[model samples]
Target: MNFREFASKNVHRNIKAYFAYFFSSSISAALLFSFTMIIFHPDFVKVDLPQYLIKALNVTTIIAYLFLFFFVFYSVSVFLKSRYKEFGILYIIGASRKQIQRMISIENIIISSVSAIVGIIVGIVFSKILLAASGKLLGFNALGFYMPVKAMIITFVAFVMIGIVISIFCSFIIKEDMVLKLLKGTKKPKAEPKASSILVIICITLLTVGYYLSITSSTKTLTNRIIPVTLMVVVATYLLFSQLSVFTIKLLKKNRNLYMKKTTVLWVSNLLYKIKDNTRMFFLITITSTIALTSIGSVYAYWRDKEDQINRDFPQAFFLSDIYDNKSKVDSKAGFIEDSLINQGIEYNKINEELKFVIPDGGKDNVVIIKEDIYKKLISMLSLNANFSKEDESLISNHKVKNIVLDNVEIEVVLKSDRGLIPTFYGEVYVVKNDIYEKITGVRGYFGAFNVENYQDTLNICNDYYNNFGYEKEDKYHNNLLKSRILRSTKVAYGVILFSAIFIGLIFFVTTGSFLYNKCYMDVIEDKKKYRQLNKIGLTYKEIKRVLNIEIGVLFLLPYIIAVIHFFFAISSLRYAFKLEIKVAAFRVIVIMLIAQIIYFLIIKKRYLLEIKKSLI
Candidate 1:
C-alpha cells in the first residue's frame, strides 16, 4: 500500500481511539465558528452593543481560539503517547523516523480537514438557532442569519492551521531514544508513587486558609483578598491531587483490613498507579470545571437578581432634580412629568422637597439636608417607616455617613437606612426636623420623587418626558426615567456577558469530559489484559463489572466532586461580595451542571464497559 493509503487505513482501523479527540476538535471548531458568525453578523452592529461588550466578545473569541490550539495540541500528544508501542513496532519493521513523521502528518491532515469541514457544516446547520438565542439574550428582536462565508473561512483556516502546527509539534514528542521505553510499555515495572509529607501538609494548609478566607470574608474585604485566595486555592487543589491524593492512597494501603476487603484490593491496587499517572489530568479537570461552574453560577445569579437590584437603587418611577435657582424650571419639568403620567393613565404619588446641600464642619464633602415632613412623606409613599423625636436628632438616609455638623450646629445621626430617599447622584443625604433644616445654609435644590403603579410599564411615557425636557447638553434636570433606561441597557449587557460565559464554560466542561474519556480509553488495552487474568482467576463478569464501575466512577466523579466543592466556596464568596440573594439561581446552575456531568458519565461508562467486555469474548 502507498503511504497515504497506509496512513488512512491506520486512522480507519483506530477510529474508536480517535473518535473522542476528533469529536472534541469538531465541537471546538463549531463553537468558534458560531461565535465568529455572531461577531461578523450584520444585525450585531445594528444592536448597538456597548464598546466594552464588543471588546469582550473579541477577547473571548481570541481566548477560545487559543484554548482550541492547546486542546488540539494536548490531545495529539496524548494520542501519540498511547500509540508509542505501535510506533516502536513500525521502527523494528524498518519504517524510518522520517517516514513515520510523514505518516503522522498525513493522518493529522486527514483528521483535521474532515473535522474542520464537519464542524463548519454543523455550525451552518445551527447558525439560525444560535443567532436567535443570542438575539434574545441581547434583547434584540432578531439576528437574522445570512451566508456566513467569512465565519466559515476563518474557522476552517484556524482549525486547519491548528492541525498543521500540532502535527509538526508531535514530531518532537517522538524522541529517538524513546523507542526502547515505548516498546517496553506496561512490561516495565514502575516504582511506588511517592508524595512529600511537607507538600501534603502545605496543600492542606493552603486549602484550609483559602476556604477560611473565602467563607469568612465580608463584602468590604472580598475584592482585596479574592486574588490571593484564588491563587492559594488553585495551588492547593493541584497539590491535593498530585501529592495529597497519592499520600492518602499510600496510607489507605497500609490499613490491611481496608485494603484487603472484597474487591477493594483490586481497584485500590490499580487506583494508586492510575492516580499517579493521571494527577495532572485530574488537576486540569478540577480547575477547568471549577471555573466553568463558578462563571455560569455567578452570571446566572446576577442576571436573575438584576431587576431587584434596580428597584433597590431606584425605588421611585420618576425623580426630578434641579438647582434651587432653577425652581421654575424644576416645577415646569415636574408638571410635564405629572402631565405625561396622567396622559398615560398612570396613578402616582409626588413628594416635592427642597434639599439643602451643605458641607459639614471640617468635611469637604456636601451633605443633602431635607425637612422631616418631606422625608416622612417620601418614605410613607414607598411603604417605609422612620421616626424622629427631636430636631437635633437626624436620620441619615445615606448608609455611609454617621453624623453631620453644619455651621457649628451639630446634629446627632440616629438611624442609618439602606433605602435611598433620593437618587444617589446627591452624595450624602440627611432627614432632620423643619427647625434643623431651616438652620442649614448651602446651595438649595428642588428634588421630586414620584412613585407610580407598575413603573416598569411606564417606559414609553418616561422616554417622552425625558426627550422633551431632560435631553439637553446643559440640562440640569435629572429623572429616574434615565436611570431606568440605564438599568435596561445594563441588563442587556449582562445578558450578553452571561451568554458568552455559558458558551465558554460549556466548552471548557465538554473538553474536560473528553480529556477524561481519552485518558480512560487509552488505558483500555492494559485494563483488558489485567482483567483477562482476573477472569481466569474465577472473577465473574459481574464482579469484574462492579470493579470497573468503582474505578470508572472515581475517574469521572472525583474531579467533579472537587470542582463542586470549589464552586460552593466560590458561590459563597460571590454572595458575600454582591450581597444579593442568589442562592436559588446558583442552585439551579449547579443542578444543571450536575445533571449534565451525570449524563456524560453514564454515556462514557457504558462505552468503557463495552470495550472491556470485548476482552471476555
Candidate 2:
C-alpha cells in the first residue's frame, strides 16, 4: 500500500486515540473562527465600540490562537507517546525514518483538513447566536449576519498550518536509538514510585503559605503579591500531585484494614502506579480548571454587582455644579435640566445647596460646608435620616473625620454618614448651621442634585442636555452626566469581560476533559491486560467492574475536587480584596462546573468500560 493509504488505515485503527484530539482541535478552531467572525462582521464598525474594546477583542483572538497551537502540540505529543510500541514494530520491519515522517505528515494533513472544514461549518452555524449575545451584552444594535469569507479563510489556514508545524516538530522528537525503549513501552516493569520526604514537606509548606497569603492579603497588597502567590500555588500544586499524592497513597496502603478490603486491594495496588504516571496530567488539569472557575466567578461577580457600585458612587441621578461663583449659570443649567426632564415626562425632586470650600484649620485640604437647612432638605430628598440639633455641631457626609475647624471655629462632628449627599467629586462635605456657614470666609459654589424616578431610563435626555448646555472647560460648570456615561460604559466593559471569561473558561474546561480522556485511552491496552489476568485468578467480572469504577472515579474526580478547593481559596481572596459580595455568583459558577464535570465523567467512564470489555471477549 502507498504511504497515504497506510497512514489512513492506521488512523482508522487508532480512531479512539485520535477522537479526543480531533474533538478538541475542532473546538479550538470553532472558538477562534467564531471570534474572528465577530471581529470581521460588516456591522462591527457600526456598533461604535470603543477603540480599547476593539483592541481587546483583537488581542484576545490572538491569545486564543496561541493557546490553540500549544494545545495541539501537547495533544500530538501525547498521541505519539501512546503509539511508541507501534512505531517500534514499524522500525523492526525496516521502515525508514524519513518514510515514517512522511506517513505522520500525511495523517496530520488528513485530520487537519477534516477538522478545519468541520470546525468552520460549526462556527458558521453558531456565529449568529454569538453575535446576538455580544450585541445584547455590549448594548449595541443587533449585528446582522453575512458570509464570513475572510474569517473562514483565516481560521482554516491557521488550523492546518498549526497541525503541520506540530507534526514536523513531533517527528524530530523520536531518535534512532529509542527503538528498543519504544518497544518496551509500558511492558517494562516499574519499581515502586517513591516520594522525597523533603519535597513533600516543601510542597505542604508552599501550599499553606500560598493559601494563607491569598486569604489574608488585602486589596492593597494583593496586586504586589499576586505573582509570587500564583507561582507558589502553581509549583505547590505540581508537587502536590507528583509527590504528596503518592506519599498519601502509600500511607493509605499501610492501613491493612482499609487497603485489604473487598476489591480495594486490587484498585489500590493499581492506583499507586496510575497516580504516579499521571502526575503531570493531574497538575495541568487542576491548574486549568482552577483558572477557569476563578476567572468566570470573579468576572461574574463584578458584572452582577455593577448596579450597587454605581449607586454607591453616584447617589444623585443628575448633579450639576458651578465650582466658580456663578449662581446664575447654575440656576440656568438646573432649570434647563428640570425642563428637559419635564419634556421627557419624568418625575424628579431637585435640591439646590450653596457650598463653601474652606481649608480647615491646621489642614491643607479643602472641606465643603453647607447649611443645616440644606442638609436636612438634601437627606430628605435622598430618603436619608439625620438629626442636627446643635448649631455648634456638624454632620459629616462621606468623610471619616470626627471634628472640623473651619476659620478657627471648632465644630464637633456629631454624625458621620456613609451615603453621599451629592456625587463624590465634591469631596468631604460638612453640614453646619446657617450661622456657622455665614461666619466662614471661603470660595463658594452652587450644587444642584436631581433625583428622578427610573433615572437610569433617562440616559437619552441626560445626553441631550449635556450636548446642548454642558461646558467642556473645567472649573466653570461641571455636570454629573459625564459620570453617568462613565458608569454605563463601565457596565458594558464588565459585561464584555464576563462574557469572554465564560467563553474561554468553557474552552479550558473542554480541553481539560479531553486531556483526561486521552490519558485514559493511553492506558486502555494495559488496563485490559491487567484486568484479564485478575479475572483468571478467580476475580469475578463484578469485582473487576467495581475496581474499574473506583479507579475511573478517582482519575476523573480527584483533580476536579482539588481544583475546587483551590478555587474556593482564590474566590475568597478575591472577595476580600475587592470587598464584593460574590458568594452567590461564585456558588452558581461552581454548581454549573460541577454538573458539567459529572456529565463528562459519565460519558468517559462508559466509553472506557466498553474498551476494557473488548479484552474479555
Candidate 3:
C-alpha cells in the first residue's frame, strides 16, 4: 500500500483509540472559534465594550489557544506511546526511521485536519445559540450572531500550526527509542510503592496550612497570601497523589480480611501499579479541575453580588455639595437641577441637609452633625424606622465604633452604619437631637441629594450637567452612573470570564474522563490473558464485572473526588476575599460537577464492561 493509504488505514483500524483525542481537539477548536468569532462579529465590534474588557477577552483567547496547543501535544504524545510496538515492527521489517516519521506525521495531519474542519463546522452551527446565551449572560439584548470568515480563518490556521508542531515534536521523540525497547513495550521494574512517614506528615502540614490560610485570610491579605498558599496546595496535591495514595493502599492491605475479600485482592494488587503510573495524570486532572471550578464559581459569585456592591459603593443618586456661606446659592442650584428635571419630564426626590462641622465639647476631632428633621427625612426615604428619644443618636462611619469614648465625650452609639451614604468620608457623622445639634456652631456646608426617576437615564443628564456646569471639590455621587458603569463593565468581564471558564472547564473535565477511559482500555488489554486463565479457574463473567467495576470506579472517582475537595476550599477562600455569601454559587458548581461526573462515569462504565465482555468471549 502507498504511504497515504497505509497511514489512513492505520487511523481507521485504531479509530477507537483515536476517538477521544479527536473529539477533544474538535471541541477545543470549536471553543476557540466561538470566542474569536465574538471578537470579529460585526455587531459585537460596534458595541462600546470597555477597553479593559477587550484586553481581557484577548488575553483569555490567547490563553485558550496556548492550552489547546499543549493539550493536543500531550494527546499526540500519549497516542504515539501506545503505538510503540507497531513502530518497532516496522523498524524490524526494514522501514527506515524517516519513513516511520513520515507515517506518524501523515496520520496526525489527517486526523487533526479532519477534526479541525469538523470543529469549525460545529462552531458555525452553534454560533447563534452561543451568542444569544452570552448576550443573556451579559444582560445585553442587542447581541446577534453572524458567521465571521475572519474568525474561521484564524481558528483553522492556528490549529493547523499546532498540529504541525505536535507532529514534528512527536517525530523527534519517537526516533530516540531503540527497536528492542519499542518492541518489548516494557518499563523498568521498580521497588514496591511505599509512602514515607515524614513525607506524609509534611503533606498534612502543607495542606493544613494552605486551607487555613485560604479560609482565614481577610480580603486585604488575600492577595499577599495567594502565592504562598497556592504553592503549598500544589505541592501537597502532588504528594497526596504520589505518596499518600500509595501509602493508604498499603495500610489498607495490612487488614488481611479486607484485603482478601472478593475481588478486593485482585483490584487492590492492580491498584498499586495503576496509582503508581497514573499519579501525574491524576494530579494534573485535579489541579486543572480545581482551577476551572474556582474561576467559574468565583466570577459568578461576583456577578451575583453586583447590586449590593454597587449600592455599597455609590449609595445616593446624586451628592450635591457646597460651602454654606449662602443657603440661597445652594437653593438656587438645587432649584435649577429640579427645574431642569421638571422641564425634561423627569421625576425626582430631593433631600436637602444643611451641615456644620463642629468639635464636640470635650473632643478634639471634627464631626458633621445633620439637623434632626433632615436626618428623619433621610431615614424615612430609606424606609427604615428609627426612634430618637431626645438623647438617642446614630453614627454613620465606615469605621467600627467600640464604646464611643473620644476625649471623655461618651455618647452611646444607638445605631452604626458601617458603609455609610458617603463613599470618601472617614470622619464621624452624628444625627443628633436638634437641641444638641444646635448647641455647636462651626464651619457649615450644604448637602442636597437629587434622586431622579429612572436613575440610569437621569445619570446621563447629570453627567452632561456636571460636564457643562459642575465645580471641583463639589462631590457628585451619581449612583446610576457609577452603578451602571460598574455593573456593565463587571458583567461584561465576568460574563466572558465565566463563559470561557465553563467552556474550558468542560473540556478539561472531558479530557480527564477520556484519560480514565484510555487507562481502563489499556488495563483490559493487559488483563485479558489473566482473565482467560481466571475463566478456566471458574471466574464467571459476573465476577469479572465486579472486579472491573471496583477498579474503574476507583480510577474514575479518585481525581474528581479530590477535585471537589479542592474546589470547596478554593471557593471558601473566595468567600472570605469577596466577603459575599457564595453558598448558592458554590452549590450550583457542585451540582453541575456532580452531574457531569455521573454522566462520564456511566459512559466509562459501559465501555469498560464491553471491553471486559470481549475478553471473556
Highest TM-score, which number? 1
Best by lDDT: 1
Ranking by lDDT: 1, 2, 3
**Model 1, stretches more than 4 Å misplaced?**
92-96, 186-188, 320-336, 356-368, 389-392, 398-411, 424-428, 438-445, 462-481
* Candidate 1 global TM-score: 0.91
Using Cα atoms with residue i matched to residue i, what is each candidate's TM-score against the true structure? 0.91, 0.89, 0.86
For all candidates in order, the CA lDDT equals 0.82, 0.82, 0.74
lDDT of 3 by residue, 523-585 (tens): 666677878889889989898888878777778887878878888887898777767788998
TM-score of 3: 0.86
For candidate 2, give the lDDT of residue 467. Answer: 84
Ranking by TM-score: 1, 2, 3
Residue-wise C-alpha lDDT for candidate 1, range 116-203, written one tens digit per residue: 8998999999888999988877767768979989989998898888878888999787865678987976466788889999999999
Which structure is stronger by TM-score: 1 or 2?
A: 1
Per-residue lDDT over 275-389 for candidate 2, one digit per residue giving the tens place of the 0 to 100 score: 9988888998899899889989988888888888778777888777776667778788788888988887888888887777788888987777888888888888888877777
* Candidate 3 lDDT score relative to the true structure: 0.74
